[model samples]
Target chain A: MTLKAQHVSWRRGGTLVVDGVTLQPAPGSTVGLLGPNGSGKSSLLRLLQGIAKPDSGTITLDDTDLALLRRREVAQTVASVTQHADTDVDIVVRDVVRLGRTPHRSPFGGELARDERIISEALEHVGLTAKADRLWHTLSGGERQRAHIARALAQEPRELLLDEPTNHLDIRHQLELLELVAALPVTAIVALHDLNLAAMFCDTVVVLQHGRVITAGPPAEVLTPELIADVYGVRAHVTRDDYTGRPTVTFQPGPPKGEVLRPLQASTSVRSA
Target chain B: MVVGEQGRALNALTLPVAADSPSRRERQWSRYGAASVLTLGGLIVLAVSVGVAVTLGPADVSLVNVRDILLNHLGLAEIPVRVSEDAIVWQERLPRALVAAACGAGLGLCGAILQSLLRNPLADPFVLGVSSGASTGAVAVGMLGLGGSSLGLSGGAFLGALVAFGLVLLLARFASSGTSGVILAGVASTQLFSALTSLIMFAFADSDEARGVMFWLLGSLEGMRWNDVGLSTAVVGVGAIVCIASARSLDAFAFGEDVAASLGIPVARTRVLLLILTALLTATLVSIAGAVGFVGLVLPHAARLLFGQRHARVIPATIVLGAVFMVWVDAASRVAFAPTPLPVGVGTALVGVPVFVLLLLRRKGRA
Candidate 1:
């Protein structure tokens, strides 16, 4: 499904948090949103997920205005794995995932067999089948994040939005999670602070600075060292890996302030100019 | 690793073992076990309380005589050989016991709804000042002689509860910060309404009608009639249905407000409807049996311990447990001072405090 945001701008208490940013993710592809802290990545994600309304702009899913759909209808199409998913109740993993079926179930009714099948499939997809009966509070941070993903998966949504899905994951689990997300046929938009991981996994990249989209294209085109330095105020070196053929950005110390900008192109002749 | 050990321990503690289709069977068994135990325990308590309560009246009716009286009334047996014995059991103790049970269940149901709506384990109809507000209205009618006709104390209590509850909700909305804001509002409104009740009582301190006001405030099941039972049952019945219908919404609230909203729950509307239902039920109970305390506060938590945190189970379990607890408390109050009648509310407070303390201590240990 095509998820498009057109000139979306949002303000919080007179401060512009998301300035006229437009994002259009190719249908059924993984798009990563990369930004430094306070660059309004989370705010933009919320706007796309319909958790927050844009101050002035339109978000549409396949030509249907998102604002026109009921919250449940929106939820049926777009599932989210947010940063703040916690509960005090002692619910089991299966039951927690089953809550994703909330929009589909009738009020005060038991889940049908189809709902149960979907929940089982979600648990299996996240490799949490064995932990299905475990209490949520007992799970580790990584396990909890996976469980949240499993819940979103159970929604059977066409599009998934994840905010910092690898926040607490170790390297192996992070790779496994991103691989699973990339393998899924559904469209996905993920926000990440780790540019290397984004480069490795995201098919398209949207870079944000001060709540504005600075550059968006394939990762190799948009993730140049000069753009990283300008957006994040960090000097970085960029190189291509022989094995993966993907651009790898490595930060390097630069000259003191007021010195000439060291252009970090692959050709050393340009840097010596 | 310690994490692996802890995970294994949790798995063992939470999972049950079985044969064919082991995991599925285990899950089914655990759920069934939980439901059966709570149901059986509540029923046993109710039956024993009814038996003992019927036998221990001022006349010293025997257990056999109590049974005969009940059986004879139902036409399963001949009218117990004695007219006076039948009268004591049939006309007096039976109605009062039924009223106590109904009142207890009503309070418990209200408590469960309040806890879920506010997302505060400490919330209950009495603590939130709903009962106090209702009592103020009942007192006004009984002492100040407002509603001087057929409508009586109940009408006054209902009106007062409606106003107090409405004000609490309005204040909570105006504050609108979330669960904490609503809880603080309840606390403030409770104090305000309680002060008003005390002020009204003092204004009529010298009047003979003050005695009725004092007794109502203390809460009593004395002089209860079949009509009171009918009224309470009708109101509580409606409240229970409303609470059950809102169970899914209540479960949603457990994850907090934003999540519930994302799940398509109209949080504000559900909360408002619940507050109104609880207020109406509290008013009905107060008008009939006065302001019985503690049952509402303790029963829901006890129900949670027995049934887990699912509202579908908690709501019904609380109602049953509440009824049983109140019946026993009423029975104990009736017999504790043989010839003299102690108010049922005092008995409930005395009984409920220790149990509540025990539950709290147990929870602390688990934590």
Candidate 2:
């Protein structure tokens, strides 16, 4: 089943936060949502998750209209992990992950053995099995993030959506987390700020700017110097790695806007202030 | 097929309520075993407290006689007693004790729900200004003799409590910060109602009349009937069911609003419904017994420590603990001063301090 949005537009507080955006992710592919801050990436992600409805447009999952699905139906099919995870009260990691079973079971239902097995398996996938009994407050920053991942994993959705998954990770964790996401066999739409990491991990990448898609394609075609400069307002040199064959982006250290050359005389004829 | 979406949710889990703090003390027991043990202990204690508390009031009644009276009423056994003695046991102390338990359970349930729903540990049954409003209503009836004494003080107080609840929600809608905003609105409304109650008392009540009115304002379980016991028990039972049903979603709220919505919970709907439920619960009890404070605020925390923070444990545990606490507190309130009894609310406040302090210390030590 595929997830596609056609000409989606949204207005929030007098501003068109997400304007006429279209997202078409190949089924079972990891597609990156790349953008500078306030480029409507997060808002668009929210729209995809059905947390927000488009003013005009259609989001279809597996050819079914997303608007027609109940909240639990959408949740069981698509799990959205936002940018924050916390609980005011103290609880353990296992119990937190167990919440993924919410949409699957009724409020009065018992915690089935299947639920426990799935939770443990999710914890294993996130490499948090050892820390399953750890209290929520006792987790390290990265561990907490991982636990959130475990919780989402336990939801066992057909499609997973994440907003900036590596924002809190160190280099190693960012790499590990991206690697894990890339290897997973489900459709994924990840909103990422790091261009190079997106290049390395995403099978497809879509760039957003001013609430519109500036460019979208395979990383090799999408990660060019001009696209970077135009979309991010940053000048960068791009190269393809010899072995991995993915494009490597190195931003030039200077004024973000391109430095253009101008013809000048040796004599100083500049205006005096 | 569904198993692969873990990748999709990579960045989905919002802000790291950073788990930077290291484990304080590892859980000493398995949650299953601990939960079962706590449940058994709570229920047993509740039963024992109910049996023993009725015997401790001003009238002379032995624990065995109290037990026999309760068992006989339950149709479990027939241990006969004198008619007046049976009346004192069955009609007087028994219902009072039972009402105390019901009020306790209801308040505890409300406290737990509000604390979790609002993400504020200090929340209680009266956080929405229900008590203040009820007091205003009851006092007006007592002072001005409104409704000619037929509708009586409780009816007036119930109406006032409902009005205050409506106002609190009205103010909550305008508030930008959600739970804290609601609390601030409640505080403002409470002060306003309290002042109005004072104005009414000043204008209409004499010294003796004011003193009589003041007792209801403080709260009492002195005259509860079997009907009061039944109604309060029913209210608490429904509240507990609702709370338990929403337990998993409440866990989602522990993180924040975004997380809860992301989990597919109808956050706005749940919050409003729960707020209304707590308001109704508080109003019902306050109408019957003034504003018995502290039990709602303290018992939930005590339950949390005794059982864990998971609502599955917290909900049921709080109900039983609340019942146990209230029965004894009411009993003490009746017997402590002998011929001159204090209001149960006053007794609760007196005992609540040390109990709350102990809970805080235990939590700190565990941390």
Candidate 3:
């Protein structure tokens, strides 16, 4: 399934938060959204997930317009793991995950055996099988994040949209979660604050600045020191790892006095090392 | 292979499985059994409450006497009894007890549905100002001497409840979010209705009118008749069935609105249905028993503590527990002061306050 955003723009409270941004990810590939705070990465993801309507253009999945589908139908095609994770009710983990089977269920029918099996498989994938019976409030923050992902997996969608999935997680869980998402067969669009983690896991990276796609391609080409300094206003050194062939960005504190940064490259480049 | 064999053995020991064995059918049975047990318990409580309430009245009637009178009345037994004794047992005590049970069950079911719909544990039918609205209506009829009839008072109370509910829904619509908006609207409507009630009472300050309004506001099962019992029972039955039917939607709502919508639930429609159902139940109950409070606010939470937060369990458990609670409260009101009866509402509040305080203390402790 190919997911594409076509010249999408969105405004919130009269402010154009996302403007003429487009991204397309191939089937079964992971695309990472990289941006500084207030760069509209989350807004773009919400647009793609059909949670927010684009002001100008269209989002499509496999050539089908997303606007034509119902909310539940969109949910079936693209499951979301958003940042707001607080639940008012106290429910057990298994029940929370079982809610993912909701879109597939008829109004009066109970969860089928196949649905239960899928829920169990999702829980096992997240290593939350043991915690399935635990109350939601009793779980730690990382566990709750994993539970949210498990819920998304329970939707059994063809694509997953994540907005800051690792925001509240510790370092180990963060790496584990990204690694897991990287291995999944479904196409994924993830918004990340940490550039190194994004570079390490994503097959493609799209960098945003002030609601526009400043650069888009492979991580190595887009995460260069000059690009980082121009978009983030931070001086950084870009290097390559010999073993992994991935771009490793290291910030090189303060730029020269009164030396203005260069503009970001208009065309994206895909480099192999 | 060994684990599979063990699982089969356990299954066989539990129940014989034929070629037609379907786990889904078995799971459905389990759900039925759980609901059945709660229903049976509630029925048993209802039976015991009726017996105890009848026997405890000032007429010096025994359990055997009460039973004999009931059986004779039903044409199952022939027993000679004084007409006044029969009157006290059948006409006086039975209607009051039935009204209390019906009111309790209605309040409890309404509370459970409201809490789930609003996603606020503190939500109750009265919290939205329905009871105050009903009181205002009842007081209006009594003060204005509008026909001086039971039907007039009941009609006035129902109208008050409907107006209050309509105002709350209209205000809630202005909120940008769902649950929080409803709660804020409820708070605002509650204050408005309460002030209106107070203003009405002050405008008609006759001693008799004031006492009548005060009694209705406090809620009472005194002077109940078969008409009141029938109204309350019908309302409770309808409310309970509607709440049970919506249990699955309530479960979905526990996750939040966005999630609920994504899960194929029509969130706005379901919320409107719940609000209307609870309002109707509250109006019926207030018309019959006056503005009884706390039962609807507290019983559902108490039920949640016993059964988990699953609405399937919480809803039924609340009905049973609420019935038992009200029956006992009415009995205590009759017997606590012997010849002089305290109002049933006074008894419930006196009891509900301590229990509510205990629940708060426990919650604080847990926190």
Clashes of each: 0, 15, 0
lDDT computed for candidate 3: 0.80
Fnat across every predicted model, in order = 0.26, 0.42, 0.25
TM-score of the second chain in each model?
0.85, 0.88, 0.88
Estimate, for each residue in B7-55, the C-alpha lDDT of model 1 and write its tens digit: 4323322333332455555555775577678778777878788778778
Docking quality tier of model 2: acceptable
Model with the higher DockQ, candidate 1 or 2:
2
Question: What 10-residue stretch in candidate 1 chain B is worst by lDDT?
Answer: B9-18
Query: Tens-digit lDDT track for model 3 on A230-272?
Result: 6676778778988889999887766522445443332122111
- Candidate 1 clashing pairs, residues 3+ apart or interchain: none
lDDT of 2 by residue, A1-273 (tens): 677899999998799988899888987799999988888989998899887889999999888888787777777778877887666677889988887877777775555555666787778767789999888888888888887877777787778898898877788888877777776666889999999999999999998876878789999999988777666666799999998999999998653453343322211122111
DockQ of 2: 0.27
DockQ of each: 0.21, 0.27, 0.23
What lDDT score belongs to each candidate, Candidate 1 first?
0.79, 0.82, 0.80
Worst 10 residues of 2 chain B by lDDT: B19-28
Task: Candidate 3: list runs displaced more than 4 Å.
Answer: A1-9, A20-24, A48-74, A106-108, A111-116, A255-273, B1-24, B68-86, B144-151, B353-367
